[model samples]
Target chain A: MSDVSSLEAEVAKLIVRTLTLKVDPAQIQPEEPLFGDGLGLDSIDALELSLAISQFYGHQIRSDDPDTVATFASLRSLCQSIEKHRTK
Target chain B: MTVGWLRQRERGSRIASRFMIWMALFVGRPATRALLYPICVYYLIFSKQACRAIRPYLIRALGGPISRRDLYRQYHCFASTLLDRVYLLAGQGNRFDIDIRGLDVLKDRVARGQGCILLGSHLGSFEIVRAIGLTQQDIEIKVLMYEQHTPMIRDLFRDLNPAVADAVIRTGSPNSMLRVKECLDRGGVVGILADRLLKQDQATACTFFGKLARFPAGTMWLASILKVPVILFFGLYRGGNRYEVHFELFAEEVTIDRRHRDREVQRWTQRYADRLEHHCRLAADNWFNFYDFWEEQR
Candidate 1:
């Protein structure tokens, strides 16, 4: 598989688990913003993502920060931020 | 319908609702909370049939194939939430003090010169929402409500909440649509519950609780038409004798792809559904839709 599809696959799994989304994981796009423009994730997902990431990867992300919004902007951004901070 | 049977059902259900409400309110406080506990146990649980009806949903959502004993414990939690909703709805409040997290989020939307559609669900008491929203905020909260049973019941609701009576805008009126549009044009807030299926064709079918259920597209359609922010608001009953109001700006999901309006509405509504499910997952019993939510879909 191409690099884009691999990144999307990783993002897809996290999206389904974090948001409890019902759609296909492979369907998630690489550059698509996860929140408003793409998957339409609401604030509840933001809270759940924060909790889920903290528990699984030991990365604590705050919701209020502007960077948090951009960081969680898409599959690529979220993965990069997680990779950078994740201790586990 | 037979007059006697209808009367019986109405009277019986309200009494049941009130009893649970009292239990939730009184059973929480130091002075009266303990006394109300046994009543909550007897009415909400020992009542048997009604309690059993709610079990499967709670079990499926909460315990998730847990052992028998743990399932029962989750039932108790659900029962407690129902009791609290009752309290919030039926109890007397001289001064309803509230703490709304992300209050500014909603306030910010309203502050903009465009009116908004406030989408909520059957999760908690919509009645308590008006009591808080109208009483706490200066913005006019025009709620879209289906008319209730007899004039007597209407009177009872009015007596319980005077502010809401003034604020409620009944659905199905030509005048109601005009008024809601006027509210939007003037930048007021129109509250509508998007969870119930108004009609079969009018709904957006989506997966809920691992099953496909229809959700009305009222929130998306209206917001898209008005080109205004559609926000999701939830009034959560927390551990204290107080509530934590959750105001989320979910307007980002409201899109303008006219070709796929139906699916776009469904997709956007799914986000609303997911957000709602998250809250319901947290406060399992605080909801009031006693009927089988997924029963009609099939």
Candidate 2:
């Protein structure tokens, strides 16, 4: 797998584990929406994922950040944002 | 993002809410209450979704088959409490017969300089709780809500009393939980609705009214982590300008060890579900969830 796909896979796995979604990591489409209609994730899941990503990637995910919504849009988007912002 | 029943997408017009507030101010309580009958009739005819939502709840609460009369009564009861909110929020709670039972539970906690969590549901008029906040000078009550879900209603509250609006802690804000923690640390009461799950909220499947349902575990999690008592508050509307606000202590502290966090979250969540079921059964008509609550949204 390419580096980008690998990152997406890792993030998808993290999301499934963190929110305890009743879906497989492979089912979470890289380009599909992570919230609302896509994965049906809510604000509570957003907060939980923010904490998980921050701890795993060593980067703060501020809910108030203007781009936070877009960053949480999909697995690929989240992976890219984390890569761009990760301190470790 | 897709909207769910609890999400703030299709809330009624802000203008209507504003109109009601002004009407209550001009016409007084009895006249404003007469308006609710027509409104209830309107919802009963047009809002099939709301009717569908209440059917199962009413049947379970009443412990018998529901009738058209029961359905209308449910809708009317909901409308009555909502109309009463205008008077309550306007600081005219003295006009109504509000009997607060077990307030000493809260008073004792606040006296000990220890903050507590006031967990409530969408069963009755939460504005009655706000009425309590108005009279109590010793304790500060901060309400935690998802403001974006009901902008028009929140605006109505803001228009009526900005101080109450300012005390609201919007749930999705970055510092929302931090603010709640701070309030609790200051021996201030923090009120939250423990019933509905927000979009993507982690919920534990539990039994409500003998059927499997999902209840949000966030309240239990917060109570456990904060090491504070959790109190259940229910303000039941007893038709014709009378309300009975009951405060029961659910837990002294919600203890969830890291090793068994998920298990503990589910257990305490069920406990809350139990208490909610008991109260909802006692006052069947007051429960007002306007959508299919048991559906698997996630």
Candidate 3:
């Protein structure tokens, strides 16, 4: 797998575990959404997932970030941003 | 999958509110309260959406079949609070006898200069809490509100009291969380209504009143992340100018272990739902969300 794909899978696992999402981590499509009308994750999940990401990678996901919409758009997009920003 | 209550257009007009405010100051409360009967009758007859929404709540709360009289009672109770809000915000709040239960919780938190979350619901007038804060100036309060959602009511209240309006932290702004954190850092109590789902993103399905319903998790998550105490508050309308404000210390601090964050959120959210249910049962007529609460598909 490409580095981006592996990153997406890693983040997908994080999302599933943090949110306790019903779907399997392997089943989360790389291009699938993580928010409204998509994976159906809510704001609580967003906060929880952000904390997990911060703990794992030392990168805090700022809710007030200007590009928050695109940052949380999909598994692939989120992982790309995470890869760019992750401190660890 | 119907339109949520928060999305519904406010039924009262600005002109009517202005007129009522003038009438409240001039005619006084007793005469003005008499006016509520006809107004409530009008809502009971005309506001189909509100009527339909309130029925299930009344049925569950009353523990039996509901009558037109019961519906009218709920409307009248709401109207009474609305009229009182005009007086409350107008700085004539001393006119009513408000019994505040569990005030020590607030006093202790503020005394320690520790910021906390005052989580309230739609059951009664949050204005009562503001009224309490107004009287006790030492306890600073800030409310998180969606200023644009209810323009008519928001504008009316703002016109009534500019000081209160200035204290509002408008939701959805990029710096919204920043403002909240700043206020908390200063040991100011930040108030948020956690019962209703304002948007699809803010909602989480939780069991309420023996059925699954969507409740907002923003307040709980924010409190947990900030490591602030969560205090459940209710300003229940007790009919005819009598309001009771109850404060229960919900959590000293919300601690979410990374391994169990989702479960922790659900647990906290359900605890709030449980408290809200208790208060709703205590003051059935005061439960005032005028749209189908259980409308969301779980």
- Top DockQ hit: 3
Deviation (Å) of B149 in candidate 2:
1.8
Interface RMSD of each: 16.0, 4.3, 4.5
Q: B1-298, model 1: which lDDT tens digit per residue?
A: 1211122233335675555445445564343445444544455545454445455567656756544444344444444444444344454443345566776766766777557777777675454454455435567778876655445556555665576576677664323454566566677888888876643126777777777766777667656655667778787555445665677888843664756778888888888888988888877655545445655312
DockQ of each: 0.01, 0.10, 0.11
The residue-by-residue lDDT of candidate 3 on B1-298, one tens digit each, is 3447765687777788888888998888998898899999998999887898778888888999999999999999888988998888888888887888998887887888888888988899887886775337566788987777778887888888998887798776434665676678789988988887776435667887888887876767778777988899999999776889999999999876656756778888999999999999899989988778888322
Error of 2 at B20 (Å): 1.8
Which digits, one per residue and each the tens of the lDDT, describe model 2 over residues B155-264?
77788888888778887643466567668878898999988877646788889988888777777877775788988999999988789999999889989875677898
Instruction: Score candidate 2 by DockQ.
Output: 0.10
Worst 10 residues of 2 chain A by lDDT: A1-10
Model 1 ranges with Cα > 4 A deviation: A1-88, B1-39, B42-49, B65-97, B127-137, B149-153, B199-201, B256-258, B296-298
Model 2: chain A TM-score against the true structure:
0.90
Best first by lDDT, ranked = 3, 2, 1
Worst 10 residues of 3 chain B by lDDT: B172-181
How do the residues A1-88 of candidate 3 rate in per-residue lDDT, one tens digit apiece?
Answer: 3234777778888888777678888877777777766787655466566668889998876745787667777788778778889999
